[model samples]
Target: MTSTALPRPPIKGSRTQPIVAGLVTSLVGYTSSFAVVLTGLKAVGASDAQAASGLFALTIAMAICAVGLAWFTKRPITIAWSTPGAALLAGAAAVNFGWSEAVGAFIMTGVLIAATGAIPWLGRLLAAIPVSLAQAMLAGVLLQLCLAPFVALSTIPVYVAPVIVVWLIFLRLSPRWAVPAAMAAALGIAGFAMGQAGTTFLVGELLPTLHVTAPVFSLEAFMAITLPLFVVTMASQNVPGVAVLASFGYKTPWRASMISTGIGSSVAALFGGHAINLAAISAALAAGHEAGEDRSRRWIAAVSSGIFYILLGLASTAITALASASPTGLLEAAAGLALLGTLGAAASSALSDPTSRMSSLVAFLIAGSGLSFAGIGGAFWALLAGLAVRFVIERKRH
Candidate 1:
């Protein structure tokens, strides 16, 4: 008799469950992040394709780690394009260097992140930070993205405002179907209006294009991008990402999460991606929802995301088409609306206690100010400002 044993089937549920959940959540989180990253690239004078390439690098790397880890763990441990990393990238690009320099820095940051992940001490240090403070920082980091749709409404009133209203209504009435329904509605309205206006929106007919740049070593770029990326990514993305996994009752090693993210980031950096990190908020959704009562089924979701992301990286033209095919108003509104819960939770925790109130406010303002220095971004400044306030307060008390 043959002695080989086939792997057990995943707990009862469709294998596609996690995949759909991962894609949906990723779409919600990445759209705003992509907008910011692409805008930053433009600010630094990168061409459209290069900017898109950056996004492509990030998503593909994340897909690999997220999918691979999930498959190994038999759990739905989803990773994503690091929003905090993207924010850091925008600042680094604007101040310290151009796309080339940013790429150099990205590789360096990935190394540091990997090292941090490999070292248990750093992981403990990260966890030692007060949970409330972590939540506050997470809130601060997400605030800008959460507000973008409303901000867009001021300029693109007809296009964005209606979608926001309908999304809000759906959010109240049917939370489960809210996102997809709002998305469908937005597209339908936009299509009808465009048709009446005698315009058509269609994906372009173009073959996939690939361009890979070898890494360049730039000390200046490395100095500027490294610390800020390390700080923001750990504080804003990894902290929350780990927290989400914990909240969902998975006890994956912090070292493992960090290592995966670090490796993913490094791999992507080699290909000109910005940075990669563990996802926090959206990950919770994928891990918690109907994908599987058993965590293993969720692994399938992450693997699917990885596959989709590979397609995205290789088929840049197709990726853009998929993103562009959606109505602008719909994408904007849906992203903002989806983040409502996470945003509220962040604000509540940040403002909850009187003891750390001042420090939290400092953190909030600096992060929200959108400041940049020597190619680093605001999240670093905010944390520094908050730590400064905390130190001062403690010093005065002593």
Candidate 2:
């Protein structure tokens, strides 16, 4: 007897899922961090046009690097703005250096980051940073930003509560869409509030306008802005980004990626953008099973993300204007909600190991204290404090 055979399921193409994943990743990453970037740029004396141009330049540079590197390496290689570096800038915005000096500092930072690839030991030194300390420092840098939502709720409940509630609901229902959903809610609420208040929230030109700032270097700017920015971008962003790729069984081209990011940062600096580097959180979306079942085909996801990033760059003028129109508290709340996951992950990683617990705690405390000395930020001091504790403790044991 012949048995009837069931028809085989139609095969799905490799490109579709990866492309979707890429687009989603780009949207989430840009929405989650662009506000912080705008705030940071303004703190460093960037005008509205300059800040918009900076974002536009950054997006284009990252898009090129992400797409080119992913295609060349045949692996998902996502690039992102240096969130920690931006946070540092927010804190140091009052520094005497003008916007030109900040631009100069950015260029120097790019040169230093690129040089790490040429000087292999520099990359190794960054890798040698203790994981616990690194995590602690990252957690500390993220603490203030993560607290923004609660702060907004306390101060502006009428505007922020709805946004936070929406975020929490979506977070439980669909984790991947949580931040984007929250951002949409915020925009809607803000728009309604503005309308009620009889405010015209005008979006400027849809196309990006270029703003060029000349670099003016000084030792103070270098020590304060350049050094700290370089450290955070490398230690906090690049190292973790590489580790993420490696964890997913991809052979990361560490030196090559660093070099590419350095060049991208330098080019972006001309347009007032800060540093761009390997992405940590968003990289997972493109590199993992979310992109595709087959690892080899996942590079397409990163490429797709890059393409979308360029589109976002083209729309930076409108985005910048929207950000300007929104209540600052509401924007902060959205950013804070988006970073909650990252904060939790960093805290867990920082305190997980018994051997490094004390040191990590010290680092977290010192960094979270927000103390600055000799123009250098707390993040640097936190690293030093943690290493000192580790060193002294290890020496006694020996």
Candidate 3:
């Protein structure tokens, strides 16, 4: 009698599962990044179309590099929009630059990122960041984003809160289904109900309009945009992103990650993409669940996510169309709610380690404060405060 083949080791979950997970996570990642880019461009004197172009570049670049790195590493290496970096760019641009200057800044940022990645010592230094501090940094980066759903509810409760609640409940029981289900439900409910009620939400177009602005090379723009951009990407985005990977079982060398990020940012910037970095929250999505059990197959998730991001970038018009099709409240609420799991996970990790608990909490609070000075955001301060506190404590003990 032929024995029934036992179920193959569940080394990898459903092949499609990772792709879907990546897509959901990417939706949030890309949208969050694009929002900052779009608004930033507007604030910096870019026309609507120019802003869209910048966003288009960013999305396409993120997709290409993220997918490429993930494919190369065979790990869940996701790319993100560099939210903190964008904020810095926005403030700097508003103060002293036009679109050309902004593009120049973007170019400088790309070069810096690429250089850091190529340097051997930088990778080692990144590796030395404490696990708890890394986790705290991750939490700090994501804090505002995670809270946006409830914040949205404050402005539009009827449309957003219900959807958020339903999505949260769905997430608890069937996380795999939660994102898509939330997305579908949010759009269907909000679009129809809001349409009948005759309210408008700000959802952009699916196909993005391309606006090519020549880059103006200037020392001032370079200093303002590039230097700060690199700092934030390293401190706010990549450091925490690496930490997340380390927190999980994947200890791939930092050289590849840094190199990929640097190269991706540089290449993307040439085409107007703001800055691309390793995804922290979205990486958690791919890393968590059964999709992550097999390191080899996990690369597929990142690859697929990159493909989706590139497609989204290319079809900016189409992306805006799809997003615009949904009610604004619904779309924002969906992204905000989807990130709920990641927010909770990072927060837990940050505070869980006994020795670093206070320091981590301090980091989390400072990062979440949303304080900015001279176009710089709280990420730098948060890291500084936490590091200073940790140093003092360590010194005293010794």
RMSD of every candidate to native, in Å, equals: 5.6, 3.5, 6.1
**How accurate locally is residue 94 in candidate 1, as Cα lDDT from 0 to 100?**
36
Candidate 2, after superposition: displacement of residue 338 in Å?
1.8
At residue 216, what lDDT does model 3 achieve? 84
Which scores higher on TM-score, 2 or 3?
A: 2
Best of the two (1, 3) by TM-score: 1
Q: Taking the tens digit of each residue's C-alpha lDDT, what string does model 1 give over 194-270?
A: 56667643444333443465666676666556655676677667777777888878776567777778877877765
True lDDT of residue 372, candidate 2: 78
In model 3, the runs with Cα more than 4 Å from the true position are 1-51, 66-109, 127-131, 134-141, 183-206, 213-254, 270-272, 278-305, 321-335
What is the alpha-carbon RMSD of candidate 1 to the true structure? Answer: 5.6
Q: Is candidate 2 or candidate 3 better by lDDT?
A: 2
Give Cα-based local distance difference scores for all models. 0.64, 0.84, 0.66
Residue-by-residue lDDT tens digits, candidate 3, 124-205: 6655566566557556656665666788787877777677676778778976666656665665664576577675534454
Q: How well is each residue in 267-386 modelled by candidate 2, as lDDT tens digits?
A: 999999999999988999999989988787999999999999998788788777766777768877777777778779888999998878889999898877777777566776788888
Top of the candidates by TM-score: 2
| Order of models, best TM-score first | 2, 1, 3
TM-score versus the correct structure, for each prediction: 0.75, 0.89, 0.66
